[model samples]
Target: MISLPEDQPRRISEGERDAGVRRLQEAYAEGHLSHEEMDGLLQQALTAATHGQLARALASLPAEDAGTTSAIGAVSGRILRRGVWRVPRVLKVESALGRVQLDLSRAVFEHPVVDIELHLGTGRAKITVPRDAVVDIEGLRAGWKDTLYRPRRGAGSGGPTIRISGAMGMGRLKVRHARR
Candidate 1:
């Protein structure tokens, strides 16, 4: 039996390789990579013995295709998104008499700029982002008694840019950095 290294990179499995290959194919189909380049990356992904190698094989591909997601939190309910999930380019969140939380510290973002449209109706929404991420809240509109607390850091610098917009009526919206 052929044994692989126990290192983190070597722990990559065949499923990961397949996923990398699929990403390369998608990049090729989207015209980001040529047929020859796709084939070469596909070969590298297939033979990748480590996670690092697999990552390098698909590094040139775009993080996310152009897509959007709509999340709704109903009355007396909670909606949360956390962990190492893929983030959509555009996210629409609506909360009514409930709480909605989106944690992006460990998420894999698909785009460098994430556009978030939030509608809070007598509800609360909290967004936790990475410390290095840039946040823009210029488009936020709040009603009387509606409050919004953002990170201390200014926008237009650092890693990804999260553009937050929309309205809050008798609700609260907070954007804070995740604790390292």
Candidate 2:
């Protein structure tokens, strides 16, 4: 990082922001960020609404060599309207020394927003939006697990909303939710 002298103002470049994103993404992926924390940070980067935010994400993620990552999710109104969804749609349902089952599903919304519901059982779930579209989501998980969902507010006004329900061993649902 470069600091500005008292006599002058400091200047930041787009490269620096990219560096931040790299760092952030790596940290989160590497298990450094709890699900909730990761979701919050990801939302911040997506909701940046400016080059500064995008740059920050690029810079925060682990520094990668040139030709590293193809744009995973860049904001685009067109994709939002299309309501297309790709990989990382997983939900776990059980957790214990024995076994568990979690179900994950999706439905076309009246709008672009994408919602998510996760019934966590025995793993870490991951997904990314390939386009910059509205994102809306609510997740419920169970059994000594954490279910976190964070989307750029207003981004997924009508995108997608996910719900999860299940139990951990002893037959008690740890997480449950249903949207009318």
Candidate 3:
């Protein structure tokens, strides 16, 4: 039998279970697993009470690729990225004296988790996320204005998660989910 490290958790957490299910779904979407196989493995991941069961459910899957990181900087003009754009795993956005708008409703996300690190001097930022996206903005620090965000009820699960961080000086950050 295979043995795990002593520091490894025995019980499975909700986040871990959710991540396992996401990996299974992504594998199925990418044609790596058949429908029947995906369904069976998904059941195993869902009903897994221990970490060992969850690991077994996700065994034999393709490893995740090393996603890329990109940067966008604007000194005095507007920085807008809307429509169908490819999203990287880590995006660093810096603006000095204009508005920053990122509409990710129709964007193609390459990774399951996207991190947006904003370093704004005085420009406000507006981000429109996907309908099924889960957003986390705990690491953000607003100097003068509060972040405008409202979590909607009934948001579907197993979608890509967006993590927003960094410092916004004297500019408000507005985030909203897509309507359609």
Candidate 4:
């Protein structure tokens, strides 16, 4: 017997929901998502209207390769790489070891404010912006130098203002901008 709602979303199977949760978890653990972004994306995944939507959401998971391939019905069954995250280009980074690596090296942030909040253990960080770019670091355990906020000349003349906040336990954060 096939029972489905006429208008609203159909209930997804436990397998689909579980898979979605796994995907969401992987994104966060990989630093691919900021706290808020993770919340939003996970919320969407959990509340997805249907199984189709849930599947789509999890389909874009980053490729994980290693001795990571396991045979499931003559096909791979691994849902995630051991540590690979499917993160977007623009993002907020957080870590417990205080290690935040950002490659803004190629991204010309057109926005006015680029805010970053990091929670870490050792606090090692870096950022590359346009030379004209301005950076404001607050709520951090170390001073400005600990964060190598550099701007690449004219490239930063009208670039965005990048802000970073770090927790005491954080590690190093590295940011590299795109080369001209």
* Prediction-by-prediction clash tally: 0, 46, 0, 31
Give the per-residue lDDT of model 3 (tens digit) for 49-160.
Answer: 8989998999878987759999999897999999999999999999998899999999998777789999999978999999878888988999999999997566546567
Top candidate (TM-score): 3
**How would you encode candidate 1's per-residue C-alpha lDDT over 1-180 as one tens digit per residue?**
665665334455443455566677778888999889888888888888988888888888877566667555566588789988888878888877778889999998766668888888877788998776777787889884544666554433335778899988887888888776
Report lDDT per candidate.
0.75, 0.37, 0.89, 0.51
Top-lDDT candidate index: 3
Give the deviation of candidate 2 from the true structure as CA RMSD. 19.2
Candidate 1 global CA lDDT score: 0.75
RMSD of each: 14.4, 19.2, 5.7, 18.0
Model 1: how far residue 22 lies from native, Å? 22
Displacement of residue 179 (Cα, Å) in model 2 is 27
Global fold similarity of model 1 (TM-score): 0.59
At residue 98, give the lDDT of candidate 2.
30
Candidate 2 C-alpha lDDT tens digits along 24-96: 6668878767777767777666555555565554554554433211122222111111124342333232223
Q: Show model 1 residue runs off by greater than 4 Å.
A: 1-65, 150-158
Of 2 and 4, the candidate ahead on lDDT is: 4
Q: What TM-score, over all chains together, does every model reach?
A: 0.59, 0.25, 0.74, 0.37
The digit string of per-residue lDDT tens for model 4 on 38-65 reads 7777877877868778866666566532
Clashing pairs in 3: none
Model 1, residue 95: what's the lDDT? 73
